[model samples]
Target chain A: MTAATADRVVAEARVCVAAVLDPELPMITIEDLGILRDVQVHDGRVQVTITPTYAGCPAMDAIRADIEEAVHRALPDHGVDVLTVLAPAWSTDDLTDAGRTKLAEAGIAPPGVSRLAGAGTSTTSRAAVALELSIRCPQCGSPDTRELSRFGSTACKALWVCRACSEPFDSFKNH
Target chain B: MRSTCEAVATEAEYAVALADDALVASQRLVEWVARAPQIEEDVAIGNIALDLLGQARLLYQYAGSLTDPPRTEDDLAYFRDERAFRNVCLVERENGDFAVTMVRLLVLAAYQRELYDRLARSVDPTLAAIAAKAVKEVAYHRDHARQWVLRLGDGTPESHRRTQTALEAEWPWVSELFDGGWLAPALVERGVAVAPASLEEPVLAFLREVLDEATLAEPDPRPAVTAGREGRHTEALGHLLTELQHLARSHPGASW
Candidate 1:
């Protein structure tokens, strides 16, 4: 294939893969979740790289399968490969602004900014960052919320109860 | 090629040791899913277990890649016998009560946070990557256990008593975690692994601060007979393996 064609193929594959939704949080696409790391096309073959939100996310397998299927459907004759990388570790900070909006609309509080952005520089300072940042309640947009549990329905979230609305919701825990 | 091969073997062994720790701990924590004191606790413990399981899966998969014939994560996790496992004895101890679980978690998470922090700089890229991601998760785990320890250790009289007792019970196992066994020293020399012994000071300091904050006294230092690193384990490990591996072993190649 021509260079231009290959570039187009890579771009097309990215769009296809990016459109695949997270299995657990169905409203958000893998791209929006920042899980879809990169898409490259070389020698008429496409390679897609992804990072997991959590180490043992059960949804990773489904996400992989979904990416493969979507890419194959988009480029019928091209070979598609999905790879999961662990380095430069994933952070909730990777989530897109669009993703944050989608999460709030779903009544799940998105994670706050990560404290580990430059973590390797100093371990002690990194650990000193407090985990209990105030999270706005999605239901009533109330800042008056209390953490009921450090864990929620899934590993990625924590349970919080909004004092104003008396509603319990999940806040995507910051990494 | 010979040196490369040897390095791969050493790295595989080191990875197995790390994986086993998370795997056994996950099994113990999974028991609290429905049995915890409250629904919130049930979810909390289950989330912690799942995180451990995730770390275990990554390590197992990395270890499998370095093996001679290569193994899948499932093969390493579900097919291995207790005698072949290489986790520290601390994680293999059976879960006692809620207090016991919290104390055990507090100690283990503190150690893991230090271990992972150091391992993130490993020469082995895959191991370093795993450690970097794992350190973040373990930070949460450590904080969770610390919170509970503070509440239970300083709360009611009954809670204080139970938590203190549990801390003492779990203390003997803590020394074993700092023991740098045969493979560890060699890996540490090569920059492929962190020296377990080096993690002792920081881990203890963190735990001491947590204990002090909770108004709980540090337990007397008494080391247990350490053998899990050598594949010898407490009887509890065998029973745990039986329950964990039963269905998978009974129905080979089974999948939902």
Candidate 2:
């Protein structure tokens, strides 16, 4: 196939792979979560790269399988390969606005801005500075929420309880 | 790759050593899943264990790529013998109590934070990337340990005593972490790895501050004679590996 045809095929494959929902958080697609790193088609083969939100996220295998299945359904004749890249690491800052909205709608507080954004922001300094931002309860929209635990149902979230609605919720932790 | 075959071998060994530390520590932490003092702690410790396990998998994958035949992460993690494992004795030591686990985590996380910070600037792109990601994760791990250490050391008489004892027991193993064996110096010179000894000053300084704030005394600096970098692990590692590798060995290439 010509270069233009290959590019179109890769673009179509990207759409298919991007629509795959995150197994752990069914509300958001992998693309919305910023885990779908890249999609390329070369020599009639499709290559999709993804990065895990957490190192040992068990959802990765399912996501990989889902990506393969999606690409195979879209381009049946093309071989599909999923690659996991660890470099430049994944940050919650990569999450799309749509992803944050979807998470909020699903009663999960979206992640706050990543404190590790700038260069030379040492861990010591970051630890010394406490996060004081108010997180509104997703269920009740109450700003009066207390952290029950720094870790919650998943590695990426923290457990919080709202005083207004007295409902327990998960807040996506900002790495 | 510009790296010579010998250099690749050395880098692979270094990666294995780092991976082993994370893998062993993750296994120990996994024991706390349902056994922690509080339900919150169970999730907390499990999250930390998963983070460490993730780091181990990434390092193992990188190491495998360096091999001639190119082993997978599973091959390095499950197939290797105890004698071939290169994690430090600190991580391999049995988890005695909650206080012991917290103290061990405090020291290891502090050391890893320093190690990874420098490693983020490695000449090797892959190692640099892994370290860059790890630095952030370990920073949180260190903070978690520090918070627990402060709370346990200053909360009650029993907690204080237990935390202190745990610190002392784990103190001897700290020296082995800084003992740079054969591959370290060469890797350091090549801008691929940090000199373990150079991390001692900063790691201790940070620990001392944390201990002071916790109202805990620092144990006397008596380094262990056994060097884990040279593959001289305590008896505990073999047992830990047996439990870790058993399922994988029992059903080779098994996956859910």
Candidate 3:
């Protein structure tokens, strides 16, 4: 493949991998979790960078294997390498707005931007900070939820019990 | 021993020391997978356990790579006799309750956080690099444990009582972590290891903050009885190892 073709193929492979659902949270893709970082194609090999959900998350190995398989299947003749990076810690804040919306829609409440939302900014042009600090319940659309545990299923989410509905649910906590 | 490069023993010992703690604790933590009080906590602890396991793999692999005898991580983790294993006995203890487990985690993670932070700047390049990466994970571990200690200690009368008892029970083991045997001092002399004693104040301060938040009092410090690094593990590790290595031992060369 040519250089330009390889780059396009690499980008396409990333999008394909992004469609792969997380085993724990089937609603969100690994990419939606912001675990996928960079993709590059060199020679006949395609290198992909993914930050782990947590330090020792078992899902990472599975995710890597899945990525490699998916990429290889997508680009038959190219080799794929999945690189795990641990420098900058993974945070729920890295979730894209669309990802958050997907999570909220799936009934797993996404984290609210407490620091950003409470900054008292009125002009909403993607200001780095806004006043949307309360995590609304995906089930009940209420902000009256209490944090039960800092850790949730798979170590990437936190346990939050909603007060309005009296139902316990998981919230993807910020790192 | 040779002068400069002759420091092999210290490097190997340091790696074993950290790896032992990680390996044993990880074994214990993985037990809580489906048995946790809640699914969220189950995954959380499992994740932490997994992190420690990773560290163990790296440290043990690094140690194996360095030593001429060439022992793999599995060899050091499973095949070694008790006397050859250098992990602290405290880490090998059973997970009593959520409170007990959290207390142990709080103390160990806090200590490890400081240890890794200092080791991140070690003269040994490998140790420094591993520590730098590990520091981030350990920080999260410390936070997870800290948050639990607070919640359990201050939650209710029952939770407070349980968490306090757990804290006191685990306090005796804290001393052993700060005083390493011959290996620790050697590494310290070479500027490759942080003295466990220097970590005491910061660790204590962090613990105090958590305890205070939990509405719990700091337990009086007692002189710890040492044995872990010298290979004197609790009876728990033997059982733990038996369970962990069962499949691997039973099905030799069995890959599923």
lDDT of 2: 0.87
Q: Candidate 3, residues A70-156: lDDT per residue as tens digits?
A: 887888888988887654546566787888888888878787653432111221112222222466777988898787766666556
Stretches of candidate 3 exceeding 4 Å from the true structure: A1-20, A112-133, B1-9, B30-48, B61-72, B95-99, B120-168, B184-192, B211-221
Model 1 alpha-carbon drift over 4 Å, by segment: A117-130, B1-9
Query: What does candidate 3's lDDT look like per residue over B1-256, in tens digits?
Result: 2355433346787798899899888888888889988776777888789789988877898898888888787777767777777888789898888888989888888788778878877898878767765765676677778778888888999999999899888888888887754353557888988887888887887788778878998889885676777677778878888887887777766655
lDDT of 2 by residue, A78-147 (tens): 9998989987688988999999999999999998887653224543443632263799999989999999
lDDT of each: 0.86, 0.87, 0.76
Best by DockQ: 1
- Pick the winner on TM-score between candidates 1 and 3: 1
- Angstrom error at residue A94, model 3: 3.4
Q: What is the lDDT of residue B251 in candidate 2?
A: 99
Ranking by DockQ: 1, 2, 3
Comparing 2 and 3 on TM-score, the stronger one: 2
DockQ versus reference, model 1: 0.57
Write one digit per residue (lDDT tens) for candidate 1, span A19-127.
9999999989998998888999876678999999889888999998898899779998888888899878888889999999999999999988876532354433325
- Which segments of model 2 are wrong by more than 4 Å? A2-4, A117-119, A122-132, B1-9
Worst lDDT run of 10 residues, candidate 1 chain A, spans A117-126
TM-score of chain B of each: 0.95, 0.95, 0.93
DockQ of each: 0.57, 0.54, 0.23
State the lDDT at B236 in candidate 2: 93
